[model samples]
Structures are given as structure tokens and as C-alpha cells.
Target: MIERGEDWVPPLPTGERVAGAKRRSGEGAAPTHPAKRKAGATERARELRLDETKAEYRLWGELRGRHLNDYKFVRQVPLGPFFADFLCREKSLIVEIDGSQHAESLTDESRTTWLNSHGYSVLRFWNHEVLAERRAVLDTILAVLEGQIHSPSPGLRFAPATLSPVGRGGGASHG
Candidate 1:
């Protein structure tokens, strides 16, 4: 072992070093408290809003400024541990725009489960669908917000097939 001078100092832990680097680089440092985490999440949500995908931008155009049924929609909202694409606090609704990567994703399924358990109804739309069939997607969201679409009970698993806009016989169905 090498002897150290009286002014010698030990190296910082790995986590601290990384955090220090982030701070020095002007990147936001990791939050250290619950409140700080919440604030960080808010900032992250803001960043996501600014860097939204094309599909997200299109949807926001329709949803923002209370353009959809006079309902206010916020984009890139941070919920428990997830960032919702859009959220209507009044209706307890969350809208998620999924890309191809989300198909049959177990993580998405679990996320939907958690949101449902927390009394939030989640609506998922394919990115392509949002871009190509904007009207239909808006219609589906409107129907749900208007209570025209019946969602499954809290404990019951929600089936995407049940709420499909296509083949609806003028009435919503729950599965």
C-alpha cells in the first residue's frame, strides 16, 4: 500500500463520480429525494413533450387547446413510474401511442395492469393508426371520455379487442 500525504483524499464512489460528471457537464444531476425526483420527472416530461414523435405531435394537435370535446389534455405526463403520452386528469384517462416494438410486449401489459389498478383507463393506439386514421382514433377516445364506451371492472383484465372502434354495433362492449 502506498503512503498518502496529510492532504490526500480518497476517490468518490462510482455513483458520485458519475453524478459529479453530469453536474459538471450541465446535464441534470440525479434526484436525491422524493420531491426532487418528482421535479426531475416533471422536467423529463417537459423534455419528452418537446421531443415528441410525429404521431404524438399529430395527436397533440387534436387533443390540445381543448379541441377534443372541450377536454383538457396534457402531453407526456409522468404517472407512478411511467410517462403517459397524453393524459386527461378530469376523466382519469391515459392515452398511449405504441410503435411496432410494443406489440405483445409483457412490459406494456403489466403497465396497463398497474394503471387500471390505479383507477386510470388506458387507451392504446398504434402509431400508424394515429397517423393514418386520426379521426377514428379521436372518435374512440371521445367515446370513452363521454362514457359511451364501457370499460371492464377494475379487477377485470381489459381486452383491447372489446373496445375496437371497428365492428361496434353502435354500443360499447367490455370483455
Candidate 2:
């Protein structure tokens, strides 16, 4: 028989202390993720849900419960080291609502590229566009989901919030 030293620490089990182990789908309930996530990721997603922006709140109202063209959407879902603002698992799409601070951010560019390579299409809309031109935003989301707008690459298909909400100008246009 082998004996362990007093100073040795036991390995942790992934199935334990993780929120998904208990129940499913709610404020604190964690969805099963393919990528390994830090415990803080689950907590942060919950916190973001609790402290949603006005833009996020308004968008969620329309997207929740398969309301957008009968497509189901989940908010604050963990995607690797980041959290998607809104995600439709079925269509592999993510929607981001941004303010002026995110205008022309290279960080967002890289993030989009990474997410796209992982098979998720990302669409971003400015806060004002979401609040003032909500119907347009919803329509755009539906277009992408229905394949009216095709993204060859997520990063190239998006324009920064600095540009048109319709994203007319990008490195590459959706066909």
C-alpha cells in the first residue's frame, strides 16, 4: 500500500464545485462548456447578467425564449477566456452590444477572429443603434441567422462600432 505525505495536496475533481453539476439554466446555473473554464468564468457570467447595460437589457427582451425568428438565445455565455454578450447555440452566432469605448478596438478584432475560427459568427451593434434602431438590429440578426448575410470570416465581416450599424464597410463583405 502507498502512503501520501501530510504536505501533499489532493487533485481536484472537475465534476465537483462547478455550477452545472447540480442543476441547469438559470441566473447561477452553469451551462456545460466544451472548453475548460475557470470557476470565476461562471461567476462572472452571472454577475454580468445581474449588471446588464441598458442596451443589453433591451436586446435581451427581444431575443429571449426563441422570440427572434424562433431562434433560442442565451446571454453571458462563456467562450474560452471571454464571455459572449449573447449567443445562439443552434446557429453558432453571437451578438455584441457596445458603447463608444469599444469603437475601433483591435482587441475586439482579435477576439472576433478567435471566436470565428471556433465556429461562431459574431455581430456587433452600437448601444444607440440597439436602443434607437432596435428593429433594424433585430432584422440584421435574423438575416445572419437565415444565411441572407454570409460571413466568410467573422472578423473581416464586421465593422467596428465606429462605422455603420448595418456594417456596410468591412475588410470583406458578406454575400
Best TM-score among the predictions, by candidate number = 2
**What is the RMSD, in Å, between candidate 1 and the native fold over all Cα?**
14.9
- Cα lDDT tens digits, model 2, 98-120, are 87878755456555644554556
Candidate 2, lDDT over the whole model: 0.65
Model 1 poorest 10 in a row by lDDT: 161-170
Give per-residue lDDT, candidate 2, residue 166. Answer: 30
Model 1, span 99-155: residue lDDT tens: 887775545654565445445678888899999999999998998888887655342
Where model 1 places Cα greater than 4 Å from the true spot, the runs are 1-39, 152-175
Residue 2 deviation, candidate 2, in Å?
A: 45
* Best lDDT among the predictions, by candidate number: 2
Give the clashing pairs for model 1. none
Residue runs of model 2 more than 4 Å from their true location after superposition: 1-34, 152-175
